[model samples]
Target: MKTESMSSIPAGNLAERIRRTGASRVVLQIPDGLKREAVPLVLALRAEGIAVAAIAGDPCYGSCDLALDAVALTGADLLVHIGHAPVDERKGVLFEHLPFDFDPAVVAAAVPLLGGPAVGLVTTVQHAHLLDEVAAVLAAHGIVAEVAPGSGRTPFPGQVLGCSYANARALLAPEILYVGTGVFHPIGVQMATGRRVVALDPYTGDAQEVSADRLLRRRFALIERAREAESFGIILSTRSGQARPALAERLAALSEKAVVITMREVTAAEMINFGCGAYVNTACPRLAYDDQVRFPVPLLAPQEFEILCGVRAWEEYEVDEI
Candidate 1:
């Protein structure tokens, strides 16, 4: 029989937190990538004589997708959620945000590509801890980096989530350098600010300038396609953090053809069953931008829907966020 590796370990405070809870039973939840750590963590907890209630098997994207319901069902006193910080604080839940470290020298690859006198710096949560080191790297290159504070859904300084680019927008710089892995965020920054964006992958040491032109073109096509729809569904999430009921109601009133639809998980099948020609996502912004291919119909952002309703112009286009 094959054996699993124990090289990796769970967060340090997990056991102590369970002890502090004074709860005999506990439920653990983690993102898909970190699910492998569940067994070991549960075994360790069981060794402590704490009853392992159950593991939340449903897909968890972020702290927004808590397994509170599962906890309630299992009668677990506490829910230990890992891999993301809380977007909003909830009782009976503990958040364990995992951090990934990388060398600050990786910023050297992005400095030469930066164009203006001052460059706004932004990164994902995993790299947010090293913002100071990254800024130091830029300073060594004689480049001034603006590491602005974030607000709303993003609380970490210089950290930009898929749903929020408040940190980058706060800088208002002509050029921005995003030190992260994916081009999706760089594209979001470009779309949100209409500024030049260069993305650097810390692990690979690769750098490239990101353009919003392609995304804009695709969004334009989606908007045009949505124009032909007779009715639209304004999707509102039931998730603790993703719920945007007020915005959903406002958008629903924009057009007679639009109706508000609340769902925990907005799947292609659900949309097809609802029979809405198009959709307006008020949940996680990534669903509309990243998962458009999986959706059968055009899913419009709040701003895009406003443009379609004639309440806002296409020139005022912006990415949707919670």
Candidate 2:
């Protein structure tokens, strides 16, 4: 297990910053996987005379009910979320810090010898901190690499959740192999770039190569599973009308005509919290990409939802449609 130290200097600076801002109570939301380092940061803050509390949960993406319950118990005036971004719908001031260091030498040495003219770089928010360094290393390796620009609509600052890499991959020029880490991030890049991707394991510094064909087949499987389900659930957004309600209504009406059981409603934390069998989103379609939410059910877009709901020959829906 590779590990990096959390910033004590920044922690102190953050403490002073908070003190100047007059916040008395501080909550440190640390992901369970990375708690080994994060615990010390919380201790450092407590030593600074700042009332600090630690909330433990998986920081992979979404809010865990146990973590949320911990936050409610803390009643913190300021929340410092470590290792992940705020996946909840509630809007508030929160700080996110991802403490993972990618060895530049590892990235440089791992550059593929066979890929075409260009290379695209994709990474999750956790590993995004190393983009500049990795890009520089790739440049030195005689490979021109581009960092896929994130979707501008990320709900959290410094956090690109839900198709973030997809947005970046879409923006990339063709004939580029996207380099990413782990199954989720690389697969996301492959989905967006429509190209082969190389995934580097953060832990062992190993590389895994994935082809575009495999990703397409995986997506087909997800769609097929949704199609075989009996009841279809549609999630609506209380915010937008043309986007959420229109899409939800279309899905509901289609399900009714097909004699398939359909359920529709506004997007709620609980919908994810309690876990459903299958759901289609009328709101942000990017929710399908956020694995951190730990959605117990398969969530798809309207068209994908239709396909999953067994609507034969359903047209594919674009992410921008919602």
Candidate 3:
């Protein structure tokens, strides 16, 4: 979704960056869509006399799941993670954020859609690098674009992830502007913060005010379907990050028919094999929200499970984040 992702030739010299690490052997972990570029990159590194010890084949959605195990197993000095910003600190991992750039003036597309005097600004990592420039553009229009300092999983100021909308939630404004491609993050921000959200696709300059009403209606239907489920499978991720074992255990305890299942990848077939009428996903909150169409059965978030169990009321509905 970024302007120049690994899908295209990456912006910086990755080999040079790896060489700077002083680590002779390194593991390369790339996202699924970017794997097409892996062979060329590996060959380039090898031709430069750098030993690429391994290329992790695991599905990598974010920096939250580093290939530390691969690095350790292959005796590699470190790992060069591509396409995402770092979610946490790890000694043996290097991140190439590959942030996207767009016309800073693109903030004007969202101006007419913003309902209030001041607005909080949040965006995906791709657009994070241009936040200050975007703010400057908005300032000319007499709009204050508030960007909160990074904290928790989202380390870049004004950056918001599908699984974490903390940056947007931290804003003090009544309305928020989300600069990115998709409606999901903006929808999540709206639900999580209970604030009006305007989403602008920086590349396309398309802007719209996002609403969670449709998503909530769908989730409510899924919850109703889950209430009739004979068994519940609370998914626990075995990845380096995205693991919520304690939360999974707690959700599993809610129902006698519920059990915790550890998985590296949660697939639709796996749910069918589990034979549970419904499943609760603790791994990657996006699995429950974004990938519900791919799943055959109801896949509820942790909070949605609480709602179904009568622990939380419908009015208290909130988006899942880790």
Best by TM-score: 3
TM-score of 1: 0.93
**Clashing pairs in model 3?**
none
Q: Which digits, one per residue and each the tens of the lDDT, describe model 1 over residues 134-156? A: 98888888888898885766778
Which of candidates 1 and 3 reaches a greater lDDT?
3
- Cα lDDT tens digits, model 3, 162-236, are 889889989999999999998999999999899999999998999999999999999999999999999999999
Clashing pairs in 2: 62-292, 226-308, 227-308
Estimate, for each residue in 251-291, the C-alpha lDDT of model 2 and write its tens digit: 78876422222222333465555445566665544566544
Specify the highest-lDDT model's number. 3
Using all chains and alpha carbons, the TM-scores for the candidates as numbered come to 0.93, 0.66, 0.94
**Per-prediction count of colliding residue pairs?**
0, 3, 0
On TM-score, who's better, 2 or 3?
Answer: 3
lDDT of 3 at 315: 91
lDDT score of model 3? 0.88
